[model samples]
Target chain A: MTVILNQSFTGVSIGAVLLLIALGLTLTFGQMGVINMAHGEFIMAGAYTTYVLQKPIGDAGVSLLLALPVAFLVAGSMGALLEWLLIRRLYTRPLDTLLVTWGVSLMLQQLARDIFGAPNVQTTAPGLLTGSVSVAGVNLATSRLFILGFALLCVAGLAAILRTTPLGRRIRAVVQNRDLAEVSGIATGRVDRTTFFIGSGLAGMAGVALTLIGPIGPTTGTNYIVDAFLVVVVGGIGRLRGAVITAFVLGLLQSVLEYSTTVSVAKVVVLVGIVAFLQWRPQGLYTVRTRSLV
Target chain B: MTTTSTPPTAAPATEPPAGPPETPFLGRFLGRFRTPAAFLLGAVLLVGVAPLVLSDFRLGLLAKYLCYGIVAVGVSLAWGRGGLLVLGQGVFFGLGGYAMAMHLKLADAAATGETLPDFMLLYGTEGGLPWWWQPFANPAFALAMTVVLPMAVAALLGALVFRRRVKGAYFAILSQALAAALAIWLVGQQATTGGTNGLTGFQGFFGYDLNDPINQRMVYVVIAVALLLLMAAARQLFVSRYGELLIAVRDSEERVRFLGYNPANVKLVAYVVAAGMAGLAGALFVPAVGIISPALIGIVPSIGFVIGAAVGGRASLVGAVLGAIAVAWAQSTLSDAWPAGWTYLQGLLFVVAVGFLPGGLASLRTVLRRRRTSSDRVGATKGVTT
Candidate 1:
């Protein structure tokens, strides 16, 4: 029973991480038709950013806090530059965008390897969240629980901004109908740039969040990107709620299966199962509005 | 075909002043040598003579290129003609390669009289071969499964995704994510799937000594024949009615649907065929290369397949085969020359190809023809005074 509880806790923590990583991809894919295959590289950038900032801040707590915005800025700027220099030209040609972004991803991965070497960098969790908590005879890692809460807070914050802010309104408008929104005096080009920045920034934040739980490495992002993409797809295009639900469900399924079977088999089974499921519901768990005003 | 005459406005250029000079037989034949049939003949000659001209090592390398060409043809069918952008061909390729590799590994183990592979013993796997892996001990079963399994998976995937109308980048991303997941899963399953080390150290293929020059040459011949057959098959499909509909779906899915045809079915058929071709290529790759690892079937390699197809002229069947072979050859030569710099050179090639030659080398003739005609017209206009 205790083992079950522990597994569930771990599953939730993993789900939280998956949610964070996938959020950016969801936004980018939803707003701009570009798949942004380099989104994983952005996560790597954030991880590296966190790793670099760790020494300057000294205190673990302060360093973690400082790494958050810095990662956002660094990754966001890089994403913006990629959009300006390469991605913008490939619009409407999604496959071309995918191939180009893949090239960019390779370049970023090689750059990271060159700069940081191939070794995994160590990171420390804050003392406040590092220890375990005993709850109902189940000892759960405090850091993981904090991460789950932090992820929820981030999601909620983003949701609120999307619902309440004028900029959010503009983004939603463009997502719904780019031509119509453009004709309505919305500068869609500006919105596209800003959306890409915010999406990439979120990926960076996810990276910082990841270091609190485990080690950072050049290829660490590759580990999570697949799961993130699965979550985004299962959640449905352009739907935040779908991503969250799918992430949690997949996370729980994977954890439970890992407990019952080997991790590798569990993963293969889950992937096969998801592929089958997507065949049934290719639009994903939810279908966004499809009324093309243009 | 339409029998409409050329427009009067376009006729002025074709009309000669009094009588146009007839081209000599030699000139006409020389010009005819540039035709598609001539190109096909030249290509066959070049490939056939390469083995005799190049060293044994280079022949083996070319054989590897042929294997990639087989897979590239499949990629072109699905991505170039069908517009599926399947970014997960690696998963199918890996499946086929691993299937063949497992059989070879088992055969080697049996010959050595070992209960388990050396790596398995080192990893402390005391148990006998896993139940699922037992079927692969039979060489014939392994080969059959290698071809069937990937096709089955692809068919299932196509039926599901296409039925739900998941086209464009969504489908591409989904497939790529699947490839990435499969690679990681293979890497993580150390005991059963051989983990990151993958399946290697095969000594023979069905009682034939793989290291013998005769066997090596036989492998090369098999690869060449298979590639030629696959390309011929792809060309036939391109000219068929089904092929026309496939391209139609790609250009306008809704329009195709309105024309009393199921676009999804058309795309699905092409997708399955492509997957089957990829699987066959992969099965052949194992015997030719004598190794199959997770590294080869990962996201990067899958993208490499797409890059080759794109660079070769995805729409042109011959271009698909030639482009894949050329890219593989370049990669081998570049890696041999400068291991570290090959990746940068590859990137530059992709950038230049995408920017300047969207139609790839296959369209080079068309571009040249356009230029030649333009220049000839310019000369004709200037010669009016003469």
Candidate 2:
């Protein structure tokens, strides 16, 4: 029972990171239908932002706090620039975007390598986040708890913005009916760029949360990108609630499976399970109702 | 992915219907024979000129590039002609390569009077060969299994995925997941799979002494001949009636459905055929390269096929072949000079070529556009696509 509780806590924490990484993908990929292969690099950008700030800022704790919003802007602007420069041109052709963004991903990865060097880099966890606390006879890492709390907070903040704000209304309108939204005087282009900014900024935040647990490298984001993408895919295109539920479920399933089997076997099993699940529900957990004919 | 993920109206203005290009009598006459002419020239270059001009070492490199060219030919048919982005072809390639590799390893073991591969002994396995590897001991069975395994896997996956109407980025992502899963699985099963180093240290290939330069040249000839034959077969498929239906499905699935055609089955056939070609490529790749590892057929190597096809012109058989060869050649030469520059160059090349190429297959885009316009008219009147 103790092991179960501890493992589940670990699982939920992993799910939190997965959810965070997927949050931005959910917006750009889900709502926009653009497969941004380089979104992973944006997460890398965020982690690098945290790394870059620690140089001048003496206090690790203060730097970590300041890094969140700064990383968001850094990654968000990069996404907007990508949107304005490349992705915007290939809106009609989604497959082309995959190739182009893959190219961009390679360049970004190389850029990271050139700037940060090939080896992995470590960050000092703040004094507040370095330790653990015991709860219900199970020891939980403070960083894990922080990540969970941070993820939930992000979810609430995103949900609030999407449901209540005017910008959210515009995003929904653009997503539902781009032509109709345009006719109604909504600039779909700006909405697209803004949506990309927020989505990528969320990915940046996810990156910030990632450094709390482990040392990050240039390819750190690459490790999580596919899993993050799977979350978006399984959750359904453009459905926040579905993404949240799916991420947690997959995370728990992975930890439980990993506990029983080897890591590689666990990964293979999860993938197969996901594929089988896709077979049963092709439209995903929560498919958007669309009237467009192909 | 989807033409547009927009929920409301499709907005037809975004997808401008294509009209047929005006071709004169001479152009039509030339077009009729250009495909065949292209293959003929390719055959001459590989079979006749290559052996005479290039050294054994250079010829060996060409043979290896031709193996990738084989995979690219299938990519042309699947992605360019059929519009199915096959991102996980590496898995199929790995499957076929492993099958052939298993046979060679078994042959080597038999020659040495051992029941286990050298790696198995090093790892201290108590048992003989694994139950799954028993059939691969037979050379004939292993040879057949190379093509059969990958095609069977493709058929099974195609049935499931296509039936569900899963496509576009979903299909691409699913395929990539398969590649990742296979690589991870192979790495885990060290004793059975030979682990990270993969299956290597082969002395012979089908009774031919691999150490001899003469036999190596013979191997190159076999690869060149197989490549030519496969390209011919693919060219035939491209011009076939089935190819037309595949295009119809790509251009407009509903229209094809209305005409009483099953889009899933059409796609499944193309996918299976492509898998068969990739399997052959992998089988040939094993003996030519003297190794087959997860590193060679992982997510990155899978995209290499796409890039090759894209650079050459995905729709055109000759273009895909030459494109693959050129890309492979460039990688071999350029990476030797400056390893880091090759990646940046490849990335830049992909962005520039595919970004400007008007759907990564310029000729095919025009073809699809024209086909869409005609299919619309025909669907309204005769309820069929030409």
Candidate 3:
């Protein structure tokens, strides 16, 4: 029973990271209909930002805290720039966006490798997040618990922003009806840029969280990209809450499966399951109701 | 209802170029075969003329490029013409390549009268050959399996995916996932698959000594011939009614469906055919390249399979072939010059092509002509495209 609870905790920790990554994807891909294959690279950039800052800041706790906004700013600005230069022109061409972003991903990966010396780098977790705490016969790493709390905080913060902020309202308006939003005097393009910024900033923060759990590498983001994409897809297009729920569901399922089978086999099983799920429910767990006919 | 008034304008727009033209029977027949004839000339030059001028080593490299050209031809049919954007031709290529490699390995073991192949001895039990690999001991069976395996898998996958109406980015991602899964599977099954090292160290192919330069040249000839034949077949398919239906499906799936045609089945056929061609290319690639590994079946290489088609012109058959050869040649030469920089260049090329040159190199002529007649810019931009 304790082991099961521990595994579930681990799953939730993984799910928290997944939620951060998928939130960005859900907004850019699910809501805006742009396939940003380079999103993973943005995460890589965030981790690298933390890695570079570790030297100047010196103290792990302070540096770790400082990395979050710096990483977000770096990745978010890059995302915004990419949206302006490439994605802006390819709005009507979704598949073309996919290819172009894939190209961008390759270039970014190569850039990371060249700059980072083609090896993984370790990032030290703050002393506050180093130990473990036991609850109900289950011993949980303090870092994992911190990640869970941070993820929840992010979720709540994002929800509040979407609910209260003018920019968020504009984003929602544009997603629902672009032409209508434009006519209603909302700056649709600015909303797109802001959405991309926040989405990519969340991914950068996920990368920061990732460094606490494991080593950072140029290709580290890619290892999680497929799962993140699946989370967004299984959750449903344009549904943020659905993304959060599905990310945890998938994370737990994978963790439980890994206990029973080899990790590779577990992955294959999860992928197959997602493929089957897609076959059964092509619109995913949730879908926006659009009145226009094809 | 919105399309009710479109036919009158669309019909005149599309019909005038061929509506009233008449030509002599011989001229019409020759015109129909013009592209194929030029392709034949190109093949002859590649196969016959190159051998005399280039050294054996250069010829072998060209042969490998030709193998890529074969796969690119399939990519052209699927992505260029059918608008499927199949991002996982590597799965079919790997399947076919492995099938042939398994047979060659088994053949090598049989030649030594051993019960199990060398890698199996280390990882797998020493009892006997595995039940699955037993069929591949025969040369003909292996060759047949190469074509059949990809065709069967592609047909099944295409049927399932298309039936679910999974397409666009969804289809692309799903296909990429399958390739990743396949690569991981291959890597994990080290005992049976030779793992990451992949199936290599072949001495002979169907009793021909690989050490001899003559046999190597023979392999190149075989590849050239196979490419020519596949190109001819693709050309025929492109000019057929099926091809027209494919274009209709691409341009407007709803209209095609309303016309009482099943777009899914049409796409399935094209996909299966493309898979079969890729498998054949992979089969030849094994002997020519002397190796097949999980590295070639991953997402990167899978993307590489179609990148050539995208750069050359996905819609043009000859363009795909030329693009594949040119890209492969560039990779080899560029990497030789600057080992680490080639990938960056390739990635930049891909981005530039997809972003600014959607029609690829084949459309250069039309683009230039449009530049000459600036008034046609709007019409050119509004041309039917994916």
Which of 1 and 3 is the better model by TM-score? 3
The model with the greatest DockQ is: 2
TM-score for predicted model 3 compared with the true structure: 0.93
- Show pairs that collide, candidate 3: B80-B314
Each model's TM-score for chain A is 0.96, 0.98, 0.97
Candidate 2 per-residue lDDT, tens place, B1-386, comes to 23333211211111224333787888888877976787788778788998989998898898899999989889988887777889888988999999999999989888898888788889887677789999999999999999999999999888998998888788888888888889888998998998899999988898888888888888888999998898888878877899888777766777788899999999999999999999999999988889999988888898888998887777667777888899999999999998778889999878876766643443445546656766677455542211
Ranking by DockQ: 2, 3, 1
The pairs that clash in candidate 2 are none
Displacement of the residue A10 alpha carbon in candidate 1, Å: 0.8
Model 1, residue B233: what's the lDDT?
Answer: 86
Better of 1 and 3 by lDDT: 3
Root-mean-square deviation per candidate: 7.0, 5.0, 3.9
Error of 2 at A10 (Å): 2.1
Sliding window of 10 residues with minimal summed lDDT for model 1 chain B: B1-10
* Candidate maximizing lDDT: 2
In CAPRI terms, where does candidate 2 land?
A: medium
Backbone Cα, N, C clashes tallied per candidate: 1, 0, 1
